[model samples]
Target: MIVAVWTISAGTVMPAAADADPPFDYLKVMRAEQMWKVADGSGITVAVVDSGFKEVPGVRSESVLPGVSVMSPPINDPDKKYPAHDDVEGHGTSMTAVIVGDGTGGAPKGLAPGAKVMPVRTSLGTTMAFAAGTEGAQGIRYAADNRAKIINLSWGDYYARDKIRDAVKYAQDKGALIFTTMGNDGDANNSGNLITMIPGVLGVGALDETGEPMELSSHGPDTDLSGYGGKARIRCRENSAWCVRNGGTSYATALTSAAAALVWSAHPDWTATQVARVLIQTAGGPVDGAKRNDWVGYGVARPSKVLVDRAGEPGAPDGDPLASPAPVKAPAPSQTAAAAAAPAKAAEAGLPWQWPALGAVVAVGLGLGFMVTVKRRRG
Candidate 1:
């Protein structure tokens, strides 16, 4: 399988120009090498649900399982039963690489290289945007039925869909842990995302090196955990050795899912809720020591605290950590117009499959005291 290698780069240290090298790499900041001794996600399966996926040459993994697709009208070839391993837009491929990449070309390794990926192609945007909500629901249910322990939804939409919530419940009932982005609209628009706001899902947010929330990270009551969302390295183009792009909760969600995979792999008998509880309990990024905050929710996830240090207690194997209904927040009027303009692709506040230049994200030195982000992913 041709896999694309992606290193998440977000925050102050990342240069604005696409051509400029990022000061940090994902592996180094996360200390993936050290944690590998405890768990490498062996026997874990992470289901990636996005518009579609394509493989990049050189990036390889042991298993990129062929899973079902819920996309209608077929993309590319009508005869093809599944979305081909062809990522026309980089989103799906990048999400997969960050989770299960074999680290063939360089040091920027995936957070959980030993895990398996079950790719479930759904409409995040483009030709299939019209049915994205229904198809996404189908994808979630399908992954749960197919033995995926962790489901990663890197894409999101502003509007809530009843079908989507039903799907989330179905997966949770089947013992699957779902992770979705907290969205990228940041504080300007706290509108909740369809997938993220669903009860029992981990709505991941982005955090910089200093444990501060990223300017673009969406926040609210439902935000579950934070991850290193910064400039990440990736083979954006087949020609370039590496390209760096600033990330939001989409990258954070993917890494958090990988973290769950690592934890589950180490203790195969642990239930999904137990894994979630331990992660929330062990997370320790914020300085205030708040049990849970709106900004970073349970603080930035500290898988190393669980894996290497063997920290945290997995309480109540059968009890659900998030059983109550999530408080639904109404979106600004503008958000509706923005989403209707471009289905699937716009994703409203979701991660753009194709990242705009750093200059587009913001001018350098926004005066927020953005800390320098530095780390690299590789062996």
Candidate 2:
């Protein structure tokens, strides 16, 4: 008898076993109350577009309103019930955890636990190779039309596609604050790294706990702001009952989006533009006189400060704070490397990986199921 073997390798993919209870106490952050004071994100909807999320023990459930699978299965057919969206790669699940995971035991808790998560499962890895066309864009449009206030995109590609930009614009018009990760690989200094700079998209970079940049975080003229995307890594569900040490801009983008949710939930009346403005104006920038760095953009997001002053009261709904920031100065290439030291070995322990204790309930076959097909119709 032969058993099929599937490996969720390190760095390349995240496994479900890594999802522990909310490990980091977001309350410890100085701005925790200020950010949470204004909004709990109770009624707003956030769309997570990435690998399907796994139906983990406590993470995902009826609370996560399951949206339709937009990525047509590899074999282009009109009629097939796409497997319920589950995270095959764990990346999507991790992002979801960061966005809305109920802070259980030391598990990773999202900034806004009260917000509703609209799961928009798209293809990753092999699925991308097959369904890279209009299907993904259509999925984005579908999520926007369905009423998602914030769209958190922890994934991105180098090749600029007009379809994606159009879809993003549509979502923005519908009042979605779109956030995307600046691709990992800035150390290589790829000349064509403007993937995050496309108009209307807020490109995010990675910063350590001490508020410094990470080297692997891509730097370009388009970067918007940095977040806690440091060496401290999250867990993957595969391999052992633990997670590996890794960091990237993907984490930063999700963190910032969740932070935005906290604010939006507090002031449900604020427009996407107002949310973006408050974040930029309140963010922590360079220590020196320099204003904004291409790598860190407006600098690390400082939600606590923003929420503190504007708590219980909404700021200008149409104000655009980021528009008036002094022109950003290009830091010497050497500055990025120096900033990398911020997420040193010491900061590594901050991100903890907790494996869920699956009761007999999880023993159900659905616990670790993967759906590779797409059904055209849903009951």
Candidate 3:
């Protein structure tokens, strides 16, 4: 696959060094504060597959597991380690803080403060590369084998490789939920190519404070969900007290991953499919469209709706929500009749008031299955 270089945008606004409380405007908008009171993602390990992760004072060291380097030529020199991982550019650290930072020393608190982070270092530079071409794939398999329930891939590329797809399938079969970013191509029509369009993995998009899709957020038929990606407040490098404003689908992906952790932690018995269903059913509000859109997929991720409101029912434990029947080579009358009869049943069932005008949506095989897709924008 032609993996794109994942770099933090220089356009990030660096706040003046101060001890004031970090503004968590995005958290407030998403009502994450309310959800945190119920479940802070305890016992959930989110594997952050990025450049590398930094262990900051605000983030408990125990919460961050020992990370591994998958870079070509094995860039694991101790001198090159930043907070014990080879993150020379600090992108992975920024993502780590958003997932598990404790908000000490005036830094922004992570959405899932109780969740643990597993750093799977894949590369050294801004762009990730593997000499053996299987390093990225191997890192994913490693994360799943180590008992990581959630895997966050905040980077993407244009090329799609069979090994990457197989790895994603392996992780999904192992009951691990994976999230990736849609490229930041800035196409208004939402016509951007993604590196991997696997059946089960989610492609996250970016949303601004106004509840509108970010201008730079990629969109397409594969976009499963959207999250807050505009100017998120994050802590600086490992031992630094400084804070900066970063924006991109990468941060959005991390935030979504944290939201998943919150829900999964609360309902440890639920399967990955169930957790994904709850998120989709409870996402967005009446102000947003009742039906899913191509830009924001199932609307913005609203974890509070699932954790606090306890809305939505997870249909099946093992069903593939994204699976649709392959286009028939020739439509038989019975198949056409079944398709025609679905809307009538759905209408009679009556969707909840929270999701107006969405009763027409149907699931192919499962009784109430709903497929979720995601995309991300580059920072």
In lDDT terms, which candidate is top? 1
Model 1: ten consecutive residues of lowest lDDT: 354-363
Give the alpha carbon lDDT tens digit for every residue of 1-379 in model 3: 2334443331345554536443437777667777888899998999987777765556677778886766554255644533336466566777787888877755557889899888887663434353323555777888889889999887764343466677777888789988887756554334353433667778777765444456577666676667777655554544254455545687888888999999999999988887777776666532323345455556567787778777767667877654431111111113333334444433343321121112112211111122334332111
Ranking by lDDT: 1, 3, 2
Q: What is the lDDT of residue 256 in candidate 2?
A: 82
RMSD of 2: 12.2
Compute each candidate's TM-score over C-alphas. Answer: 0.76, 0.74, 0.75
Q: lDDT of each structure?
A: 0.64, 0.57, 0.63
Per-residue accuracy of model 2 over 66-149 as CA lDDT, tens digit each: 776665654566575454366666766667766777655323556677787787766553435335334446667878999988
How much does candidate 3 score in TM-score? 0.75
How many clashing pairs per prediction, in order? 22, 26, 11
